[model samples]
Target chain A: MPALILFWILAIVCIGAALTMVTAANPVRSALSLVVCFLALAVYYVTLSAQFIGAVQVVVYAGAVMVLFLFVIMLLNLGAPVTSSTKGSNQNTAAVALGAILLLVLFISGIFFEIPGKAVSPATAQAQGTVKAVGLTLYNPHLPWLFPFEATSLLLLVAVVGAIVMTRRQV
Target chain B: MLTGLVAYWDNLRDGIYRLFIFPEYWHGIRLPALVPYVALAGIFAFTLGILPMLIWIERVVIGLMQDRTGPNRLGPRGLLQPPADVLKLFFKEDIQPGSIDVRLYYLAPFISMLVALSAGAVIPLQTVTFRNVHGGLYTVPVTPGNVNIGLLFMLAASSLGVYGIILAGWSSNNKYSLLGGLRASAQIISYELAMGLSLLCVVLLAGSVQLDHIVNAQNTLPFGIHWLPSFLKGSIFSWYWLQSLIVPVVIYTVAMIAETNRAPFDLPEAESELVAGFHTEYTSMKFATFFAGEYVNMLMICGLNASVFWGGWLPPFNCFPFTFIPGFVWYILKVMMGIFFYTWLRATLPRLRYDALMNLGWKRMLPLALVWLFLLAGYSLVRTATAPHITPTAVVTVAHVAPGR
Candidate 1:
């Protein structure tokens, strides 16, 4: 019961922070609001018993990625409120259309799709969220996840190399 | 009459023990549920309480190094100077620069202190044994937040600490402050990679990310040489500083010094260049908050080094006299030694050039850490393959499962 209450509180914080991130005029404020949103999401992960994921979420997104975001914003001197002349452009109509499509997709999935696995008990969820459990599941040869995990890592490496190549002409 | 007196003394001892260790209830509330809260408060007090002493220790050590008397007038050997300084900070006029962002400028120092304090949650002070209803003894680590992913949590908190400096620099509306913040974010990000990698070496060897598990893994004969005498089982030699071949420890130490923004790596606040850096515009208690936060961060990082690399709470040797000392005392002593090392380095080395610092962090430490990690991982894999009968993972799982909470 307490966990449920805490989850609701975090849910409110997560949504509020996301809204603030979208609406804030200053780029630095927007990035910081996004960080708060990420943190709230990480807490929600912990409450759902995905402890490893929660830690990774904060470490990767809130810690590393958002710092880079703010670094770029500051480097480019974009902390001041941006004044764009394209405010009433067709981009707004396209954004609204995309948002409607996304909402429709989420609603349709929620109503029609049945999740594959059985609902795990709290004890099992706790067990599954441990570092050991996650490691074994990801690395076990018998499991189907190992190949996909390696492939995703390879893709990330390729992306990194591509970024370096694009940035450094001499290199 | 002597027997009656002895009985009374025994009763008094038992009453005190029960009151502290096995209290069942307190004013209609279950006491066991409150242990985490109590431990949290204790951790906070311990961190804050040590700040003044840490400041005094740093001053005295630096003074000795520089052949100065230090703060000798306030109390016996200037023991009272830190308190005086704190009082002065409290009474000083609070200043806010006219051009600064009011909200974030006010928020930065609090963020600094908050992040520093939060990182202490997962640090295990010591293990305490208690008697259960079955009259059997069980030992549990006395951490405020004994989560499984403690090492990762520390990494996250330390990573978040960069925001405080960056915000302070940006909001100060000063060129020096902005530059300081920029340097801090870049330096921290670069060093964090090496730091995480070094910690990963420990995690790989311990086969667990939990701090207590990492500490306990060190309490064994070096290289598991069972032929050694029993007295040599849990000694300083068994610690990860030796077991991991000293490379990761060296890397971690350098990275940690950089991470904490201490001297030699303290380009962010280079006195000659940046004029006090991020806190140039801060004044009074707000400035003090940033100062305390830096010291607290130093303590937290040093405590981590002590626990992860040095044998935390474990005696240098598992001998009769050494074992007689309490575990937390040993832990604190080791942590203080780490602090002394910090002071020693601060006095000895000059600040690195900006480009040189970046080169050391990225071009040097990052590649070395990666290579070391690869080598260690290969070695561990080969060992596990050869010694299939005695799998380390199996042992780790069994040990972890047996201590179910």
Candidate 2:
């Protein structure tokens, strides 16, 4: 019962913070809201048994990433009013409509796919999810995923090259 | 009595297991496992509470190194200095600049403290035994979550800490702050790549991502003798710290120093140039958060270096007749040593020029890490190929043959 209440509270905070990030008039307020969202996400990660992930989420996303974003915004001499494009064309509206539809579909599907309950069974859950278990999974039957993972590196490399090229110009 | 004790032990073991692996089960029985939660709360408290003491320790150590008396007023040898400083900060009125973004400024400190505090969760403070909420058995772990993705998780989070400085700098709406933040973000991102690759050598060697497994692998040498194990009759030099890959470890340590923005690399908060850098505008408790966060980063970096290069909590012994100290003690001791090194560097070295910092990171450390990683991978391949092929009978024959022959 307490779990349910705690989860609900975190969920509310997550959604609320996310919304604030979108609508907060000041850029700093938006960043702060984002931190709150990250905190909620970290809590969720904890509940999910991704303890390391949870800690990282709090440390990196809430602590570090948001700080950088805010730092950049502040550096640009930005104020309460960020450079907003009210040049919202029909295309922007259409995109928003599509996003809303997608969200609705996801929300409705969640209601329909009621998962059958499976408890941790105590002993098994305890022994599982260690670094060893994860490594075994990553390098064993799911070893095929390693290829895609390495391939992603190529994508990142290309992106870096592209960024450098774009940023640089002939003197 | 033994049976009762055994049953209690079993229950505790089961509970801890459920908590990490079957988080859903953990969620289900969390109410009943309030004791474990409370214990976890204590760990967080310890992480923060000890940091201030570390700061004082750093000052005193640096003073001793420099042949000066440090913080001698507040309690014996200034032992109570940290508490006094904390009390002072607690009472300082938060000063909000008229021009700055109010929200980001306020949130920056909280972000710093949160990041610093959060890293403690996955760090094994002490080997714990607890009652399983469901199985009525012990669900304890010798090591926490032994997760293969431990290094990756740590890398990702450390990378994120860069943003905190950047945000603090940007939100302050000062040129120095903005510059500091930008430098910090870039520096962190660049060094993190080197740090990850350096540890990748260690990962390649052990062929395992779990921290405990790496330590175990290091406990035995390549030729089969535990070289550094003085207590054991015939163990020889087997620490990963002394491995041929120690080059990469050194590079990794340098990168870590840069990543944490300490000493020579601490340009973001360079007082001479930036007038306190990113958090210049910060005052009172908010400033305290940044202060605490910096120390926490120092701790996390120290712990990471110990875990990856050193045998983390593993003591320097082949086998002790009687084990007295715990794993946590070794881990903490190693971390303190790392911190001591950081302070020593700060006291002795001059801050590098911005261009020099950038150059050293990109030109020096990065290349070394990349080269070392490839070399380690090659070595691993060679080792694997050289190992004699053996069936189950051969394994048994070899084991018997060694003693008999």
Candidate 3:
């Protein structure tokens, strides 16, 4: 019963922060709201027993990525209160439509999905979320993940080279 | 005084319970849910308790280094100076400049203090081995958190510390504040990679991510070389700093200095350049909290490094009368050594140029850390393959004696 209550509270905070991220006028406020959403999502991950993923989410997204977002927002010389200009009406309409679709998908998935009814045993779930468990799965060739990791590495290398080449000539 | 404090706390707890209508027992059981939080609060109080002492040490050391008497007027050898400083700060007015981001302005220093305090939650001060009144041994680790992911959690929390400085700089909206924030974000993020990699070397040598396992791994000669004569054995040669060529320790030391933004790596808050760096515009208790966070972080990093490099809570050798002393004394001694190292570096070294600092972090420290990690991994792997019997002891029995090492 307590778990149910916590899940609801976290879910509310997550959704509320996500809404605030979209609604906040200042770019920095939006970024701060995004950090709140990320933190709430991390707590949600922990409640579901994905402890390693939860830590990684906070460490990576909220700690590293959002800080960079806030930095960029602060650097942009847009220190004043920001309102969406008339030129971005189309973008605003598209965002609203996409959000509506997302909400619809959530409503449909809530009914169709098993939705935690057949929960894994606590022992197995805890084991599944542990550092060793995640490490083994990620590095295990039998898990079909090694190829994806190699591909990502190769893609990053290419991006680095491309960035250097582009930066060599004045844009 | 200790007993008085205990009695006062018990009275307060009971008074709150009565006021809130909380039952003393629910179905013949006391509340277990509040135990961990209460323990955590104690840990926080302990972490913050040393701030005044730290300030006194830093000021005195720096003064002696520069050939000046440090704050001798406050009390005996300036013992009462920090409290006086604290009082002055509390009485000062908080200044909020116009054209500032008020929300983030208020949020910055609190983030600094919170991250600083929480980062040490996983560090083990002493270990399991106290006998109960029944003469049965009961073992409990003396730390706020002892999770399997202890090291990673510390790394993550330290990484989060960048945000506080960044936000403080940005919200102030001053040119110097912005520069300081940007410098801090850049410097901290650059150095953290090297720090993480250096710590990875310790994890590899111990074959576990847990800090307790790491300490236990250092209790014997390197690779458990039992052939050492009775004259030369345990703790001294067993420490990873000696075993792994001390490269990790060297890299860790430099990275730690940079990570804390102390002098030499303190380009972010350079007084000559940024006018106090990230906290340039902060005043009153907000400023005091930021000041407290820097010293607290220094202690946390020092405690962590002591555990990783030195044998934490372990006497120098088993053959000595050093075993008579409590183990936490050794841990405190090692941490103090680390703090002394910080002061020594600050006194001896001049601040690096911006490019030099970045180059040291990225080109020098990061590559060195990577090389050390690889070397340690290969050495440990070879040792395991050659003689599986000599692997470092990484486990502890729950009912074992009080002194872990």
Candidate 4:
């Protein structure tokens, strides 16, 4: 019962903050809202018994990376309520239409799929939530997935190099 | 009927008593003792300032190590210097540069402190006993969130500390801070992967991710005998650090030093190049906040290394098995040793060039970590296939050890 209440509270906060991130006029407010969203996501991760993942989420996204985002936003003087003259109303309409379609598709899928049975509570899941479980999963039957994990890291490397190149040119 | 009423009255009395004094009633049942989370917080807060105290200590030590009086005017033999400097920094007006984000700028310090504080949660403190109303005794692990993911959480949290410096640099509206932040982010992220992998080697040997479990697993020396007896017999004892893990430890130490952004890897604030780096525009308390954050991070990283590589809260050798030196003392000593190393490096080493820092993290640490992890994992595989399966609890009990290490 308590889990239901907590999940509802966190889910509401997360959705509200995500909305605020988009709607806030000031970019700084938007960034702050994003931080709230990250925090709420972390709580949700905890509810899922992904304690390590939740901690990683906080440390990497909220603790370190978000600070960097905020720093950039602050450095850019994004606190000001800036006005934009360029407004593509047709583009906005199209985007909204696509988003609504996607939502509809998800709803249809949810109805058709009828979701799987609920998993055990986090307390019960603790038995296999250790680092060993993650390692075993990473290496054992899921060894094929290793190729993609490595490939994704390679992609991150390329992106990082690209960013450095772009920024260095400016400097 | 009277006897039944009397019993009913007794039941009602107990119910009312429990409703009013629930905690007291609950105490009647044996439960795990609570780790003093506040005590951990207090100690972490204390360590945040130890860097400056370390500065003072360094000066005193250097004076002792060499032959000179370091700072005599601030107090009797310059004892008051750090506090005075801190006071001056406090009174200096905080400057928010024009065209910078104010909220993120202010938040950088809190994020840094939070990461530092979170790292201490997994540390084991002294064990306590609790008695329930039924007079049953229960033993509880004193570490907060003594879940199996202690080391992982520490790594992730320390990784988060990088953002504070990155954001400080980027948000300052200064080129120096931006460059510093970028370099630090790149450096820290790169090295953290290696640190994670290197620690994985030890985790593989222990077959568990719990820090206490790892320490306990180390208690029995290699080949089913103690290290001393093995030494007398001219056979090496099997602590993971001594047995095929020397390379991993070295890799771990190097990556850890970089992770903490200390000395040679102190790229974020290379005054020579970046003019105080990320906090270039910060003044007064803002500057102090960044300073305090770095020191706290250093302490945390050191504590983590000690816990992971050195048997954290584990007394050296079984000289006093059941000899009760409290767990917190061992934790403190290990952390202090790490701090001492940081101080030693400060006195001895110069900052590395930015290119060198990046190259070391990628070219050296990452590759070494990868190789080391595979070796450990491979070894574990061989051992597991050949050896019989041992449940973690059975191993613990057979080893004749306490759960808290």
Regions of model 4 farther than 4 Å from truth: A1-5, A20-36, A55-86, A104-123, A126-171, B1-31, B36-52, B62-68, B75-77, B126-139, B222-240, B320-324, B382-405
Cα displacement (Å) at residue A128, model 2: 9.7
lDDT of 1 at B2: 62
Of the candidates shown, which would achieve the greatest TM-score relative to the real structure?
A: 1
Candidate 3 achieves a global lDDT of 0.79
Predicted candidate 1 versus true structure: per-residue lDDT over B1-405, tens digit per residue? 966875676566556545445434446675555656766787788889999999999999999999999889999999999999999999999988998999999999999999988999998887765555566655677788889999999999899999999999999989899989999999999999999999998888788899888998888888676688665776999899998889999999999999999998999899999999988999999999999999999889988999999988898986555765778889989989989999999999999999999999989999999999998888767766665433355344644554452
Residue ranges of candidate 3 with Cα displaced over 4 Å:
A75-83, A87-91, A115-118, A160-171, B1-42, B130-138, B229-234, B392-405
Best candidate (score: DockQ): 1
Which regions in candidate 2 have their CA more than 4 angstroms from the true location? A1-11, A25-80, A83-147, B1-46, B73-75, B125-149, B226-236, B319-323, B388-405
If ranked by TM-score, best first, what sequence of candidates would result? 1, 3, 4, 2
The DockQ for candidate 1, computed on C-alphas, is 0.53
Residues B243-274, model 2: lDDT tens digits: 54579778878888998899878988899998
When summed lDDT is taken over every stretch of 10 residues in candidate 4 chain A, the lowest stretch is: A133-142
Q: Tens digit of lDDT per residue, candidate 1, span A1-171?
A: 988889889889988988898878888989888999999989888888899999999999988999999888888888799886778899978998999999999999899888789877899899989988888777666668889999999999899899778878783
lDDT of 1 at B205: 79
Span of ten consecutive residues with least summed lDDT in model 3 chain B: B394-403
- Across A1-171, the per-residue lDDT of candidate 2 in tens digits comes to 987998999999999999988877788678767877897898787666665566557656764567657656655656457655664668768978999999999989887885589766635643344444443444443357667777899998899799779868887
Per model, how much of the real contact set is kept? 0.68, 0.32, 0.29, 0.41
User: Considering only N, C-alpha and C atoms within 3 Å, which residue pairs clash in candidate 4?
Assistant: A64-B163, A71-B171, A74-B100, A74-B101, A75-B101, B28-B132, B28-B133, B29-B132, B29-B133, B222-B238
Comparison by DockQ, 1 against 2, better one = 1
lDDT score at residue B55, model 1, on the 0-100 scale: 92
| Residue B326 in candidate 1, Cα distance off native in Å | 0.7
Q: What is the per-residue lDDT of model 4 for residues A9-95, given as tens digits with 9 covering 90 to 100?
A: 998999999989987887756776897899899878877877767767876787667766755665565646778654665886788
Ranking by DockQ: 1, 3, 4, 2
